[model samples]
Target: MAKTFAIVVGESSGDQLGAPLIKELKKRYPDAKFIGIGGEKMIAEGFESLFDMERLSVMGLFEVLSRLPELLKIRKTLKNHFLQNPPDVYIGIDAPDFNLPLARMLKAHGIKTMHYVCPSVWAWREKRVEKIKKSVDSMLCLLPFEVEFCQKHQLNATFVGHTLADKIPLEKQTLQAREKLKLNVDAPVLCMMPGSRQSEIKRMAPLFIQSVNKIAQSIENLFVLIPVSSEKREKQLQEYLVEASFKYQIIKQDSISALSAANVALITSGTAALEAMLCKTPMVVSYKANALTYKIISKMLTIDYVSLPNIIANREIIKELLQDDATEQNIVNAVLILMGKNEQLRQIELFTQMHRSLIAQADIQAVNAIDSLLLSK
Candidate 1:
C-alpha cells in the first residue's frame, strides 16, 4: 500500500512552488495523490484540482470580504471531501486567507495539516499567530527570520531556505539570455513588472507606462522590457500599453531571461523582486491595494519597507514607492538614480551580498524537514 497525500496550492506562485514540492513529496511516497485548489502547473504535476485556482488569486482584505460566501463554500467542499477520503497529510501552499481555514477544518477532523508558507506574522496582525498555532501541525518557512518568530510563538516551523536559491543560476549568466532575446548589448534595459493580477495591472500599468514616457523623454538609448507571466495577463498588459501608446517588448515565458537582461526593474512587490535579486538586477518596488483594504492594513503593518529585498536586508537598500507615493515621477526618479554609476554599483553589491546569505540547499532541506515531521507524528 502507498501513502496518500492531498495538497492544496492557491495561485501561480503557490502552484510554481507546489509543483517542485509535489515532486519532492512523491520521491518519498511514489503513489501520493495531490488534490485541491491549484493552477496549471499543479495540474501538470498530476494534481486533481477542485476548481481553477486563478479564481482564488485575490489580494487585499476588502477584495476577499466581498467574496466571503463563495470562499466559504469552496472551503466547506474541500473540508467534506477530505473527511470522506482522508489522506496521510494535507499541505496548504500559501494563500493563507483560503488555506488557513481549510487547514483548521481538516485538523479538527483529525487530518494531519501543514502550511508550506508562513504568513507575514512579523509584518502585521500578530493575532494571526494564535490561529496558525491551532490550524497547522507544522509550517515550512522560506525566510530565516521567520523561524525565530515561529519558535517564539511555539509554532512548529522550519527554515527551508528559499526555493529560488535552488532554481536561479548563480554564475554570470546574462549574455546568452540577452543574445536569445536579441536585445542591444550597449543600451541599458529596464524591465517593467506592473503585476500579475488584473486589478494590479489596472492600478499600476498606467503609472508604469507614464514613468516609461518620462524615462524615454530624459534618457537616450534606453530600452524597456515587460515580462508577462500568463497569456491572459500578457493580453491585458498589451491592452494597457496600447491604451497608453507606449512601445516596449513583451517577453512571454522567459521572465528569468528578462530579469537577467535588465539593468534595473520598476516592479510591484512579490516573488518577482526576489527573482530580480537573483538575476543581479536592482529594482524600485511599488505596490497599491484597494482603497479600503489599504487604509486598514497600512495602519496595522509593523514593517517599514514593502519589498522582500529591503525586508531581508533589515534596511531600505533599494527604493520603495507604495500606494499614493507610487507615482510616475517617483518611479522615474528612483530608476534614474539606479541608472547612475555609483548607485548602480551599490545596488549590485547589495544583491550579491543578499544572495550569499539566502543560498542553502532549499529543496532537499524542505523535503527532509517534511519527512521528519511525518516521522515525528
Candidate 2:
C-alpha cells in the first residue's frame, strides 16, 4: 500500500505551485494517493479536490471577516474529515489564512503538516513565525532570504528556487512574439494588467482606465492590450471598461503577447510585473488597496519599494506609484518617460540583468529541492 497525502492550495498562485509539487511528490512516492482543495491545475494532475479553489481565494481581513461563518463551516468539515481519516501528510500551499489554522488542527491530530511559500512575515509581521511554528511541521520557502527567519524559530525550512525561474521561457523574442500575435511592428504597444482578483479589479480598474485615457490623450496610434484570465472575468472587466468609457483592445488568453507586444506596461505590483520584466519590457508599477487595509499595511511594510523589479534590484529601476501616488498624471508621466530617448534601453538592460540572476535553475530544480527536503527528514 502507498502513503496518502492531502494538499490544500489557496488561489491561482498556489495552484501554480501545487501542480509542479504534485509531479515531484509523485516521482518520490510513485503510488501515493493525492487529494486536496485546489484549482484546475491540480485536478488535471490527478489530485482529487474537496472544493473549488475560489472559495478560499478571498482577500483582505475585512473580506475574510465577512465570509467568516461560511469559512468556519468549511474548516470544521475539513477538520472532522481529516481527523477521522488522516493522511500521511498534509501540505498547505500559500493560503496562509486558510491553511495555517487547518494545519494546526490537523497537526494536533497527528498528521504531518507542511507549508509551501512563507507568507511575507519577513516583510511585515515577524510575530507570524510563532503562529507558523505551531501549525506546520516544516516551511518551504522560495526566496533565499527567508530561511534564516524560519531557522531562528527552529522550524524546518528549505529555499526552493522560485517557480517563475523555471516557468518563464527564455526565448520570448520581442519581434517574434509581436509578429506571432499579429501586432503592428511599428506602433508603440502598452500592456495594461489591472489585476487577477475581484477586489483588485474593482479597486484598480477605474484608475487604470482613467490612466489609459490620459495616456491616449497625448499619444497617437498607441496599441493598448489587456489580458484577462477567464471568460467571466473578461466580461466583468469589459463591463467596468464600458462603464468607465475607456476604449482598448482585449487579448483573449495571450498574456505573453501583452508582454512581448508592448513597448511598455503599466502593471499592478505582482507576478504579472515579474513576467513583464522577464519578457524584457519597460514598465511602471502601481497598486491600490482598501482604505482601512492600506492604512494598516502601510506602516507594516518594511521594504522601500513595492514592485518586484525594484525589490529584486534592491533599488528602484522601474518607477512605482502606489496608492495616492498612483494617479493618472503620474502614471501618464511614467509611460511618457519610458517612450522617450534611451529609457526603453535602460529598462530592458536592467530587466535582462535580473533575468540572468534568476536563471540559476528551472522547475526541475524546484522539484529536486522539494524532494531533497522531504527526504532530509
Candidate 3:
C-alpha cells in the first residue's frame, strides 16, 4: 500500500523549502500520495494543494486579524480533511500561528505530526516552546543553534542543515553572473532587495531609491538592480521612481542573479540576509515595522541581532539598521562604509565557512527524520 503525507507551507519561502523535500520523499516512497496547501514549485513536483497557498501568506500580528474569518474557515476545512483521511504523517513548514493550531488538533486524534522549521521561540517568546512540544512529534531545523534550543526544551528535533546553503555553490560565481546580467565587471553594482511583499516595498523602497542617488554621488558609475517579486510590486516601485534619476533596472524576480552579480547588497533582515550570506555577497541589512507591531516585538525580542547571518555567526558580521534607525542617510552611509572599507572580501571569507557548515544535504536528512518518525509511531 502507498503511504500518504500531508504538508502545509505558509508562503513562497516555505514553497522553496518544500519542493526538494517532496522530491526526496518521492524517492523514498515512489507511490506516496502527497496532499496539502502549496505553490507553483510544489505543484510542479506533483503535490496536490487543496487551497491556494497565498491565503496564509500574511505577516505581522495585527495584519492577520483583518483576514481572520477567512483564515478560520480554511483552517477548519484542513482540520476536517486530515481528520477524515489522516495521512501517515503531517508536516507543517513555518506559519506557526496557522500550522501549530492545526497540528495540535490533528495530533490529539492520534495522527503523527512533524514541523519542518523550528520557530524563533528562543529569540522572541520562550513560552511558545510548550505549544510546539504539544503540536509536533519532531522538528527539522535548518540552523545548528536551533537544535541546542530544541534539546534544552526536550523536543525531538534534528539539524538537517539549510537547503539554500546546499543549493548555492561555495565558490562565488560573480563574473559569470555579472556577464549574464550585462553588468560591468569592475563598476560598483548594488542589488536593492527591499522585500517580496508590498507592505515592505512601501516602507523600504523609498529609502533604497534615495540611497541610490546618494551612493552614486560618492562612487562613480554606480548601477542598481531592484529585483521585484511581482508585477504589482514593480508597478508600486515605478511610482516611487517617477521623481528620481539613477542608473537602475527593475528586474523581475531573479534575486539570486541580483545578489550574485552585485558588489554589495542593501537588503531587509530575514531569510534574504541568509541568501546573501550563502551567495557570498556583503550586505547592509535593515528592517521596519508598524509602530505598534515594532513596539510589541521590540519589547518581546530576547536577542540583540535580527539577521540570520549575524545570529548564526553569533556576532555582527553585517550591519543592521532597524525600526527608527532605518533612514535614507543611514542606508547610504552603511552602503558607502561597506564599499569604502572593501568589506566584501572579509564577509565572503566568513560566508564560505558558514556555507560549508550548513550544507548537510538537507532534503535527504529531512526525509530520514520523517522515516524515523514513521518507525517510532
Candidate 4:
C-alpha cells in the first residue's frame, strides 16, 4: 500500500522550502499520497492542498484576530478529517501559530507529527519549548543553534541547514546578478527592502523611503532597487517611492536577485537579512514595530542581536538599527560605510564562512529525519 504524508506549509517561503522535502520523499516513496495545505511549488510536485493556501497566509496579530473564526474552522475541519483517516506522518512547515496547535491535536490522537523550522523560542518566550514538546515528534531546524535549543529541551531535532543557503552560491556571485538586473556593475547600487508583509510595509516603508531620499540627496548617481513580494506591495511601495526624490526601480518577486545585485542593502529584519548574508552582500538590518508591541517584546527577548547574520556568527557582523534608532541619518551613515570596499570585504568574508556552514544537503537531511520519525513506530 502507498504511504500518505500530510504536509502543511504557510506562505511562499514555506512552500519553497517544503517543495524539496516533498520531492525527496516522493523519490523514496513513489506512490505516496502528498496532501495538505501548500502553494504553487508544492502543487507543481503533485501535492494536494485541501484549502486555498492563502487562507492560512494571514499576518499580524490583528489580521489573525479578524480571521480567527475561519482559521479555527479550517483547523477543526482538518482535525476531524485526519482523526477519521490519519496519514502515516504529518509534517507542519513553519507557521508555528497555525500548525503547532493542529500538530498537537493530531499527535494527541496517536498520529505521528513533525514540524519544519523551529520557532522563535530562542529569542523570547523560552517557555514555548515546553508547548512545542507536546506538539511534534521532531523538529527540522534550518540553523545549528536551533538544534542546540531543541537538544537542551530533549526534543528530537535535526539541523537541516537553510534552504536559502542551499540555493545561494557559497562564493560571492554578485557580478552575474548585477548583469542580469541590468545594473551598472561598477556604480553603487542599493537594495531597500521594507519587507513583504502588509504590516511591515506600513511600519517601515516611510522610514525606508525617507532614508533613501536623504541618502540620494547627498550621494551622487546612487541607484536603488526595491523588491516587492506582490503586486499589492508594488503599488504600496510605488506610493512611498514616488514621493521620495530618488532614482529607484520597483521590482516584483525577485528579492534574492535584488539583494545579490546591490553593493549594499538597507533592509527590514528577518529572512531578507539572512538572504543578503547568503548573497554575500553587506546590509544594515532595521525594523519598526508597534510601540506597545516593541515595549513588551523588548523585555521578553533574551538575545542582543536581531538579524540572523549577526545571530548566526554569535556576534554583531552586520549593523542593526531597530525601532527608535532606525533613523535616516543612521541608515545613511551605515550604508555609506558598507559601500566601502574594506567594510564590504569584511562582511563578505564572514558571510561566506557562515554560508559554507549552512549548505548541508538540507532536503535530504530533512527527509531522513522525517523517515526516522515514520520508522520509529
Worst 10 residues of 2 by lDDT: 360-369
lDDT of each: 0.82, 0.79, 0.88, 0.87
* C-alpha RMSD of each candidate structure in angstroms: 1.6, 2.5, 1.8, 2.0
My TM-score estimates for the predictions, one after another, are 0.95, 0.90, 0.95, 0.93
Regions of model 2 farther than 4 Å from truth: 170-172, 243-247, 252-254, 360-362, 369-377
Per-residue lDDT tens digits of candidate 3, residues 110-131? 9999998889998999999998
Best by lDDT: 3
lDDT of 4 by residue, 1-377 (tens): 89999999877678878788888999999999998999878988999999977678766556677899999999999899888889999999999999999999999999999999899899999999998999999999989889988999999999999877888888777798888888888877899988776668888899888888888877789999998766776887777776778888877777888888888999988778888999998999989777766787789999999899888888998999988898889988888778789999999999999999998899999988988998897
lDDT at 97 for candidate 3?
A: 94
> Which stretches in model 1 have alpha-carbon errors above 4 Å?
244-246
The order by descending lDDT is 3, 4, 1, 2
Candidate 4's C-alpha runs over 4 A off are 58-63
What's the true lDDT of residue 107 in model 3?
A: 97
The residue pairs in collision within model 4 are none
Query: 61-83, model 2: which lDDT tens digit per residue?
Result: 78788889988888898888888
Q: For residue 115, what is the lDDT in candidate 2?
A: 85
- In angstroms, the error of model 3 at 328 is 0.6
Residue-level error in angstroms, candidate 2, position 249: 3.9
Model 1: how far residue 67 lies from native, Å: 2.2
